[model samples]
Target: MYLTAVASLRAGHADDVFLLKRPGWVRDTLKQLDEAKRLSGGELFVARWMSGVVRAQVPGLFGERAAAMQDLVWCLAHADKAPNLGWMREVYFHLAALHRQRGEDAAARRYQTLSGFASETRPATFTTPFSEAPVAGHTFSSRLIREVVPGAVYLLSGFEFTEYYFVVSADRRELIAIDAGTRADAARAAHEALRARVPSLPPLTTVLVTHAHWDHVGGQRYFRSLSPSPRFIGRGNYKDELAHDAMANPAGLQLFFGKEFQLADVLSYKPDVTVDRPTELIIRGTRFELLPTRGGETDDACR
Candidate 1:
């Protein structure tokens, strides 16, 4: 019965993974798990473990649906079951944000205080291509552009010194892009550079987004609309980050870019493959292990 309940929740397709995050489903699932736990008697450990997993994941799995899903009572009931304070940090932050959004200053402050880290201590500035420092340990100058060996990959530079890569396959039959430039001009420059130098390159087959920051994803739509549109690969919370940064109704674009911000270009695209933790990828026989970071440039970033 426990296995049956778990199997029912498995994602059968890309859409199911992101679409089935409603609170009603969670409530129903929890009820079923609790029943299974009761029925299992002495062998209830598996059901108990699964229940704990759902409790911890429910906060994030619902992402932008926080207003309806962030039930403090539910969390308090399972406080003892929480893995650790560090694991609960994001949950605390989200609760704080939700309270703050609703004008409950006292409640907001309470949740913020509960968060393990001081929010103000984080740097407001990020080291981008515009910074004198190297990006991911690769340096570039006004005249120098970034390049990777063997297959001859090109990294175009622009906005916050935004750098996007154009990866050519080992057999030159496919192109794999990484991030689009910050804006139209930057994307145009990258596109033009590709046309002028790598004209023979084939259609893009895949795009791996390092994070959901504006500088990294601004040009994604431009690339996605192109012929032979590529499938996106990113972390599971990638959509939530997109919602937070660009599309979360009021607090997203309105707060950052202002009310004048155009909603047309901003999109919350689903990743074809979502990684919950460090995972390996093989692109055209090339193996790459994606590792999660404590967030170097942004909280959603992976190294």
Candidate 2:
């Protein structure tokens, strides 16, 4: 029911005054989220966070600033309990915007700084091993490398916008990279950094991409240049998805990837192996089950 309301709200453009002004839609949506919270076993933090976001949005369109500020403040007080850095950052950014709307410059600046700090520290705090995870809202501005599963799996965070992972085979003879990252330079630097940090790590023999998104496959060319070029793997619909994105938003490519991003690089990336259905792959001794699934972000996704 909560998901249904969210979908409806999204379809109706929840921010539009027409939907917010509808007799009981917004109010009932909040009520449903409240019920969802009650039945969430104290684990669904997103429900509470969504409610706060809706309340924050109501003020500008409906002139309910006082009530919205109260809910936003409550969310701020409990921001530490947010499920991830992205959620925590949104709460801070919302508060900053609300304070700015109310003419509270100092308060707005404080939350803005907190939001930037959250963005800077996100890669490290969430990707590190569970036992060694950093405190919430910790501030740092450098890349981080951590062993997620001791000797078998490791994480390379903070090199680029997306996090990359390296997995070792059971016999420790082969290494596989999870994603290529956003740019060749960034990917090359991350790969070199990992090898430098773990000199005994095995040669990278395979590169598996979760999807055909620009950020995930941009570094394919670099990986292809290795001594024994690693075999690339991606979803069967990879090319179709890339073509769709290229036709739909060709102009926006450089906005996120910078002016230097080349569309030809992304369009030319091809996986040596493509999985359209459930497939089992054994790299050296480590086994991986590849499942292609559709998601809100992209239909050509593999897990």
Candidate 3:
């Protein structure tokens, strides 16, 4: 099962893995393993293997980066099970890349070599084009620019992810919530702050997710559950990638948000609004033009 799961992940059939899990495979497996433990003298490693098989197929389906990352770490940390060396190598190489981006050359090199992802196979070694900092904790509105367009445009820079864009109509009634802070706590805090600043503004009619990483989408669940729930939007391809990452890793809770948060914590909120192609929407009178972009951080992004 573990090997099958790995093949599915590499083959890009992550959705199937989640379908099996939604029915409660993990809980069922745990029960069976508990019975096995009672009958046998020792805890069996087979249970671990079975779980990894299902997990390795799509680690990121948990819909959060911290969750995806922790799962990747768990897979690598487990030595006793009949592990998937390739999956371990891929995750380690990815971690090495993350470390190099953060300027941890020593740690980067360590992971690269340990995973057998040598410098020769790829382009330059230790080249992380993205920011290394743990994504900035704060954000502010960019200078307002009066353009030919119908609505006002605001730039959001110095963020943990790429810059953010928030557009509001000339009339204060219509409003749309753009990117929130990265990490669940940061995102949640930012949303609350935005609310406190503008007390009379209408409820958020729409939320546009630029991409589907934790930093970008962490507050999405929180925002979606508001009283007059806002319509959430994302590139159409967004869900599959997010889902794949969650199932394969299932470690996002630990790696990104810290270990206290877990899968059960995130399932409470899933994306209610998803869009495949670049689209536009008018929320409470404010209009937004969402353009899709692809780059170093995610396969699909909204600009």
List model 2 lDDT by residue over 1-303, tens digit each.
Answer: 466357337524655657436636666665665566667653455665665666666536555556556656766676555544455665676677788888899988898787775431233323222221111111132367789999888888766556779999999999999978766766787899989988998999999999988888877778988999999999988977788657746446555554445566677889998899999999888999999999768999999
Tell me how far the alpha carbon of residue 4 in candidate 1 is from the true structure, in angstroms, after superposition. 74
Kindly indicate the candidate among 1 and 3 with the higher TM-score.
1
Tell me the spans in candidate 3 whose CA falls farther than 4 Å from its real position: 1-167, 180-184, 247-256, 259-273, 293-295
User: In TM-score terms, which candidate is top?
Assistant: 2
- The C-alpha lDDT values of all candidates are 0.56, 0.71, 0.50
Q: How far off is residue 17 in model 2, in Å?
A: 40
Highest lDDT: give the candidate number. Answer: 2
Expressed as tens digits, the lDDT of each residue in 1-303 for candidate 1 is 655356337411223444455556566666666576667662443354444434434554544334223333344445544343233444465566666766888977887787654772333222132223221112232323456664468765532245678777777777777765444444555776666666686777887878876656656667777777788887777766777665345434334333333344445456787777989887776566787665666666766
Clash counts per candidate, in order, are 2, 0, 29
Q: Give candidate 2 regions above 4 Å deviation.
A: 1-141, 248-252
Clashing pairs in 2: none
